[model samples]
Target: MTAHAPPPHAAPNAASERTERWWHRATGYQVYPRSFADSNGDGMGDIPGITSKLGHLSDLGIGFIWLSPVYASPMIDNGYDIADYRNIAPEFGTLDDMDHLIAEARERGIGIVMDLVVNHSSSLHHWFQAARASRDCAQHDYYIWRDPAPDGGPPDDARAAFGGPAWTYCEEVGQYYFHFFSPAQPDLNWQNPALRAEIYDMMRWWLDRGIAGFRMDVISLIGKDVDARIYEEGPDLHPFLQEMHREVLAGRDVLTIGESWSVSIETGLLYCGRDRDELDMVFEFSHIREGWHPELGKFAPKPFDLVAFKRALFSWQDLTRDDGWHALFLSNHDLPRQVSFYADDRAHRRPAAKTLATVLHLLKGTPFVYQGEEIGMTNARFERIDQYRDLETLNHFEEQIAQGVSPEAFLAGANRNSRDHSRTPMQWNAAPHGGFTTGTPWIQANPNFGEVNVEQDMVHSESVFAHYRRLIALRKESDLVTFGHTVQLMQDDPDIIAFERRLGDERLFVIANFTAQDRERELPQGLAGQADCLVWSHTPRGEIPRSLRLVPYESLAWKL
Candidate 1:
């Protein structure tokens, strides 16, 4: 699969014709602050370190950075448990550093999107502390609390997402508080008007600081009805979202992306529908979940089924075709590396990474590049559970081991799906600690950084980073790539993932081989012809042949 000598079409001037939002044609890059880079020899990445690395992101041509949480915390859940919303974590630097990072990133046309973890606050947060100390305080009503059951146990047998019971007893208050995640993180009571007002005010404060927007953490659980065990997309969800929009997001030219683990195609539009005014997009997990064991969940691994994965992915594309927008991503701070999880990381790492990026970036949505993903990072195949740092992974290890699961068996699963795979220090160069820190890293860097670092990839001809740079540039210049409607092809083909992007008469066809073996796929009659080559992974060709033979992990895009 290749292209002819026909020159690519002139860059489209569609911005003047359409009232497009800044993000519609932009690409997002997520920065897990703790693992990105370390300055001051602290062994932990900070805002100053992130500021120093802006040139790398600028070179990649990202429009925004979805920075993971760096708020004041006790280091539980890797900063997801927020202790203070308005301040920065001491380990991550100060508020001045954050302001500087925003200013510096803005100078390079990259907006910094902060992580909003309003669904819960750290147990150490002042509000939570006050709430737990006294049931008579105003803050007591700011969190979900209920009386103990007749048997003096929890209000219900609900389980936390990390592990153990969801309800934690507050002896001082003589009641139990609900937490969807770890007990160290207490659920916020969105039903309380005062609590809502405080959240709105905090959001306004951040927006006033000139940050881009927010990538909301577990937003679907905000309107949970704990009494009924309805934690996801509850009845009050939209109303609360609508209220939040009215208060904080309505007139602001900022992007808001809600993260929903349970958002399905059936209820997709409710969050990002054109008229909904709730969120610009959602980080839904239907496609990612398809790779997990059904009943056993993420810990227990399952074989990657390409067909089912396509169905889940393309379904969202279909759902957002004419209505809501999509948030394109494969890896994140909470997920395993894309090359290791989705494709052949060991043998075909570079091409497979490029192929994955090709399929995702060409889709009609704002694509996100996780830190180190552009360089084809692999999983931290830790042999022991102690090598892991994620609370979710560590807690699950204990639970599974206690349930008669062997330590070796649990370690195998953790190696495949642990969040720490993506949390390892970013591979910057071949230097010690992957050049991420001057001191010992808080988490051990992937040992393969010597072979798969950004500096190394930038010099290679077949570079994943280079491929991503081209894709990002293509989105910014090509109107067809930005607004074209997606039409999935070869949905049933297990070895091939193909799709067409059509905007009026302009068409961009993309195809990728998802296997380690050579694959011969019959191109659709309408798609076979001489065309300008948009991008290719393995070899550049002269034309789109009727019978296309793709090398292992080869990907190509043709604009016709």
Candidate 2:
């Protein structure tokens, strides 16, 4: 098979040539507040807890923190269902606490990127309450609503993402309201000019309070046409995004990333093209979904396919080489732990974690490290269904059990792929409850925390945290790592992932053995030469020989 040639980099415009954004060279770290740290001995993690850990984040050499929602909420979907866009949840802390975090992190050269959840609001939100109470109020149009069907049922049988019908009847207003996820989250009506203005004003509010930017939650769904059943990349998507850019983002030197599960390679640039003025990048799931069962979805995962996964990932590399940008990551709060789900999390966990980090961080994009990821944290092995705190997992358990899926069988799938796996308390040390709290933890800590906590990893020479720090430092110091054109090699090799990054005469080659077995491959003529070792998981190497052999889960990168 012919090797795929690297796409040529687009010529930088006058503006881009003179200046580069901070995010261009810096890596991001995600902090899930409720699991990060506990300040007041509360079972739940709060904003102050995150502040206390700023030193740890700074030590990791991250540029920013993509903070998950700490907004006022009832915790229905873990802060996704916002009751007040401008306030913080009492359990989390106050607005003063949030400002302090932004200030403190900025002092350490870290920006706090807040989560923007505008697609929906909690049923308890004042606007939702007013809309449900009376049809005469202006807030009534703030949400999507429809008259009942002739048969006095929901307008249609559209089911919610969580479970049951998407339409919920509000007896006070005598109309049915639409929700994409749960009835508790009423979909916002973007078609309303006043509602759009409110969202823009709210975004500006956060920006003025000294935030870095926003990681928009399900932003693709904002311009959804519920009446036509067009949710993702609908007709108004680009227009709304452009308007948002012009209204609140044009002058700011901040980064914006949109989260889209339905975005595909064909429409990738529409959301983040340099000229589109929509966003800085997007959190796409095409590569992550490669391991999911086609018919059964994430719950019933298929075996890992390295070839298909490479195709999905490399396509984005090619697409963004000339336009737009990529958001590189393998794990997040919504998915299972990378080491547990994608690689060996048992005996070879450390090496496997390093290999995964090597492949993702070396890619051409902004890399984000999820909390505990740098320490190679594995998934939570919950024996019972009640142990899960995620509404998505619990709701699915109920639906699957009713459909004749045995409790044992569903539990097995949940164990393999559950959001709660990533939501467990961040293991800081070997103390009780993993040093996450002094009281009972909101969720059970992973039993292996004693061996995988950050305190232990930092002291070890070959720890995953050290590997991540080196990778982050390399990106900041090497232009080739930040802007080189990527050329993926060994496309058909199922056991090894190899790629070469080229910028002018400089080249950086990276290779990783993804399996827990010895593997060998012949290097291409262009890749065989003396070079400086940039990063490695096992033994360090000084040159790329014609024939290369890698031990189990070994990874190496060299600059040529």
Candidate 3:
């Protein structure tokens, strides 16, 4: 089936209207441009490649596409370390190519949301370049630059997320600069009103071109403490962000999804203000962080807190009830695939993914599906640490090696944990490089291609791909899946993740076995009236009785 433009008069109810305005009432697929598709056969994925795959998105019932960072960059942070905010990278595509992609998407009733990486710029950015060129330059205040500590050493105890000092010493300016991520990605000086104005002007440029909005990267990091000696935050952060809202996003229909990682709900709501309306929605960091230990960095070493997760979710929902929207997501470009997290139960990839998909889609927040997630992608294995391309991975390898860490063990950890796990060439087919390129791919594709590609699953009715198609289709056709109030039942179940989505008389239960073992649980006491199974990864065959006994990894949706 091909896409035709959505009819202008396709009106929806009030609950859904609220959702539609937040995300255009659409399923958004997140694509990391470098690994999505390769049109030029240059081995690297690019915009023309993504343009070609628009049909795949259309077929999957996607309403909008969130393209992650095609901006001009040094690739230090995989395009997050932007050198130019206004131009597209030569490696990705040209301005005309992106324009055409936008037009074609609109023609297909789909919209575009590009990555908004305003928190920082690549150290090589023109602003940073000029700043480093001279201390007295007009752009010198564009970045956070400081001097040595009172004891005459590097700044106290501020750790770089990737493993070294967060501050990088600059011989040119004879000062230390703040960079929460890699040193190459210098933090922007949002404290400067002049710099904030310029960022908003750039935002206007994209909005004026009819682009829908932005998926802001590390937006919470836009504010940093200026006085704490090491890691202290001052009260001035709110005023600055409020001013940003007034200047950049106010009175516009454009959606703003900020990455409020490391920010509290209080701060999150403040960033996504109600009265002033700073942001439309903000991504809560805790969703994708189920398995992480703070000391372990981004990767997970053990199971996460489900009860804690619920508290985090409900708190945000309550806090933003009358204010901004919430951007609910489980996986994205920066982490390992969901299969890696929930796939311990090898018997139920389809059911588990379907169940997780239901929970995210039916929440009050706007749902986001990462690239390759709909068809159920998993992590890949790497034999050597040197083969990793991610800057953080490389930094960790070097750090571990310096600390006398075992080389074999280091690569093993990197293989199971690196960001590259999600960046591998998307498995399009069983062909070489998983059909991503006729030439050598920029990165190796997962070896499970024969069993995982879209082509194979599209032809099989029982395949995971087909299940995702149905799930997304359900979201498109119903208000419950898009705007309903959510109540997670059996949240305490160690092996099952079950939740209910209700909009007045329309109620549905989404249950998935997170583990492999067949288990039984008494349905939560609150579920009343007759409830019939509506959708399941497997057919609603003889299995889903009134007191359903969910199979291993089986996912089912029941209507009450």
Candidate 4:
């Protein structure tokens, strides 16, 4: 099943148009290039590593692949602070290697989606260097630069997204520059039309290189606040996005997914509605933010709230059902493993993983699977703070410790929520370093990799990998699972998540018990004895009658 590529500028026909919308029901898998696979025995994953493992994704039954940033970078933010947009990082591979990987992935029925990080560039970037050389340079406006405050202090009191002040003073220019993240990353000046034209040209260059599309990073922040605030939202975002679409993506049969923060139903309509022409899909950061407190950061602990989670999920579903598209996901490169975060990784990892996958996949959106998620990977065990490599985690630990926080408590928080947990090498087998590499991996592998790995799980019928494969199969096989309208059932049951999908008499029910204890729920009207089970997290338990019993973390979907 090789991928079918549409002509570069083909005339619109019914079949071609339908094919253009193929991403609506597609299952996308995200591969963090540095952790996916290491083909060169250099302890770091690269484009060749991903190309060598294309068969694994094909075997897992994914339609598209999303590769995290491999662009030329100083690795200050692990490639997010890109130094060059058009070139591949030396650690990842060369331009030829990237082109080869794209071609190989297409041959295996996998469309490649590169990570686009245009919000900021590495301080080492030529443009940033030129901007910092002198304020009178032509490229001075390429990045956001401002004069110091009245009393010869820092610029406006905006805080960085990671922590601390957003402005960094430069002695050479005698001014301050704003960076939403690290000082090594300076935000681009999207208000400059010349910079916008340069970005559009770069996108066209990639599209012409036979790559499919992009997963834009912090794209919402591209629209700056008129008052120079550091917030994620702005008023002029739509116009910029619209112009981008018209200039670069008007006729290309490609997908553009944005990491949009502070999203609402109104924002969804403006960003992803069929008529908006801004983006194909946007990832709203509501449910993923459930475990963190408003004042406390990700390092701080907050008990998971089931009601809040459900409310956010349903709100997005209802909002997008009519006019917009969503990019559904649980775990990504930035967060801990979903099963470990949401379920008991020690007791019921398999069933919990399956339940999460079923609920997200059966919903009305495109599903995204982060690398190693298929095999129930747990969070990394970094007992000491020194074991962590993420800049955000390390800097946060230092900041909190300086502010009178205990090292013991801070390490505990970092162990629980650090991004390094998700950056561990992929568990290919039970060999040394989980068969991820013959040499030492850049980061440590999870100790549980011996039990939870691709080789062992791929052959096990009840493994999380097999369960995800079945769910993806159902999504491709059933129309109701793909395009049906969603309705919540048994909304008052806090332990049970039940939903109905209906598409012109093709009715389907998805019910799951999210806890480790068995739950029994009264069946809805017309559902009892009418269900023919299609997919289940556990073995079939006969027919779903008037009173249905769901095992621990069990999820089942049936056709009526």
TM-score on alpha carbons, each prediction: 0.97, 0.97, 0.91, 0.96
lDDT of 2 by residue, 385-418 (tens): 8899999888988898888889987887888899
Count clashing pairs, candidate 4.
0
Which 10 consecutive positions of candidate 4 have the poorest summed lDDT?
10-19
Scanning candidate 3 in windows of ten residues, the lowest lDDT window is 1-10
- Between candidates 3 and 4, name the one with more favorable TM-score: 4
Summarize candidate 1's per-residue lDDT along 2-94 as a digit string, tens digits. Answer: 010112343243422324678887799999999999988889999999999999999999899999999999978889999999999999999
The C-alpha stretches of model 3 lying farther than 4 A from their native spots are: 1-24, 150-152, 229-234, 304-323, 345-347, 525-532, 541-546
> Per-model C-alpha lDDT, please?
0.90, 0.90, 0.74, 0.85
Q: Residue 396 of model 4: what lDDT?
A: 89
Q: Model 1 — which ten-residue stretch has the worst lDDT?
A: 1-10
TM-score of model 2 relative to the true fold?
Answer: 0.97
Instruction: Name the runs in model 1 displaced over 4 angstroms.
Output: 1-18
Candidate 3 per-residue lDDT over residues 170-288, each given as its tens digit: 88988888888888988888878799889989988887777877887876666667447433223665576677778877766666777766667656666665454567777777655
CA shift of 190, model 4, Å: 0.5
Residues 1-560, candidate 4: write the lDDT tens digits: 12544233321222223333667657999999999899988999989999988888888889899999999999999999999999999999999999998888888767889888988999999999999989999788988888888998876788787778899998899989989999999999898999999999999999888878889998999888725574576766788999999999998888899898777766787888777889988988788787786777788867777777888888888887766778899899999899988887888988888899989988988999999999989998688887889999988887899999999988877777889999999999999889888999999999988999999998887988888888888776666787777898877777889999877768888899989899888888888875688878888655668888888999998888
- lDDT for predicted candidate 3 compared with the true structure: 0.74
